[model samples]
Target: MVKKQNIPAKEKIVSVVLLAGLILFMAIVIGPGFSEPSSPNQNVAEQMLPAGWSAVGGWEIYPKGRLYEKINGREPLFDQYGVVRLRYASVSKGTNDFEVYFYDMQTPDGALGIYLANTPSEFDELELGTLADISGGQVRVLKGRTYLEIFSLAEQTPKDFLIDLSSALVETIPTEKEARRTAVELLPKQGRVRGTLILNRENTYGLAKLTDIFSASYQQDNDEFDYMIRTISPSEGRKMIAAVGEEIFEFDGEIIQSETNSLVAEFMGKTLILNQTGDFLIGLYGAVPPDQGRRRLDQWIETMKDQLHGSGK
Candidate 1:
């Protein structure tokens, strides 16, 4: 029998401490009892609606369970936005008919995401509640926990009628206590394309692991590319960086720059960069000529840092 070698006492103590820390970390990440509350089943469709407009018919409420059955093909999109409830109404004012749809999303951000996804390019920004966008025949608004979509069936429906209805509804809904400026606001406006910012609530850039990401189009030297960013807890940010590192390595990507807090990789005929700073994971994707990408990222970092710090966020 061979003699057994004993581990050093100090080394054993260190190992024990590390193992305990690992257990605690895992517990915090995956432990039970931290689940979010289920959406309420109540329907408030007719609660605060204005009474002046004659109801062409009664309102229909689709609770969380029935939303899929009601919306059919578009159920997946509503689910992606964390929809809790939906209300629909059909009314007529003289010769004009209107179809009013009210969506009860889980949060303001969720409502905003749905609003962005549904609105068209010609919608004009309206000064109502958190944000409101109106087109010639449609009006969409994002308030505290709801998104309102009012569609005018007749071409003759006056824009004033749409504005009045939107205003009335906004006044009834609760608004956010304080408006939170989003990370998208920090993007440099110099080379950015207008109306190109997209807030993805799910499956951002086909990366299922990454959700609630914001992407925008940018132009440099007539070359168009997209960049994305998502704000998460510092711990989660670091974990995401580690996961992405593995993915890039598997794709045979070269790491051009690696540091304690930042990583830059070149892959698939393009350059991609990832950085974490104070609970934010910022990235530049599809940039050519590594140097240009780096410069753009540096500029974005500087601007975001200044803006966020100055705002005391």
Candidate 2:
């Protein structure tokens, strides 16, 4: 025997609606992990193939979690720059092969961050993407929100091929015109050495816990010096000072305490004049004396202030 209860049409509709809502919520919470990563539609392979070259296969996509499978030991560097996804493809021309890697780094700055961290043995600038350079056997580019790399698998890597491929890749990626001006605008430009500016995402100047630092070299009075700037929360700055207090003292040099939380010290022939103002840390490194270093640091701060005030930024 079976017993059945007749449900009202409105009740059935409400029940179905409730179930649909639940499913939607679950999808919102857990769907992304299972779904395919949303990689940019870059139809690059067809253009990359030369007359005799053949693509090995379709593009291979690697999300952050699976990036390690492709890069292995270098995953952390990509992770540091907020890499979204990686689209990779390979092609072979007889015995000559080439690999193209497109890393979606989330933002232009994120792309540049990774680029700055890479200290290449030599730099040959290329006028492709936002910033591009050829180093060793690779051509690296930072354009839009992407960090693209093309590696040469053959002994004879033609510079013309690299240039053409880089130009093509740059055309595919989007760029923000306004973002072209970066924090470099905040820095005083006078006497700055071209091609000497760089960003260190972490552990700047071999100081542990010092991160997101921008530095440049300036030529003054027949001498060159490094000026560094970093924005940090007051609490984090204090914590860094506390964490590195012992290490700072361990330097085999004269330590001159000029002001509270500010020091002019000589370490390994370099004079370091570090000053903390609110949420900003500024330092100048040179062979100058403590008094000269302090005066120079103050002048730089004033110059920065004037620049900002003039720009109304």
Tens-digit lDDT string for candidate 1 (125-193): 888866688888888887777888888988767888888877877777776564545565455667877
Model 1: worst 10 consecutive residues (lDDT sum)? 33-42
Query: Largest lDDT belongs to which candidate?
Result: 1
Candidate 1 deviant stretches above 4 angstroms: 1-61, 68-72, 91-95, 119-136, 183-191, 199-212, 220-223, 302-313
Candidate 1, residue 215: Cα displacement in angstroms equals 0.6
lDDT of 2 at 156: 81
Output the lDDT of residue 191, model 2: 89
Give the TM-score (vs. native) of candidate 2: 0.60
Worst 10 residues of 2 by lDDT: 304-313
TM match of model 1 to true structure: 0.67
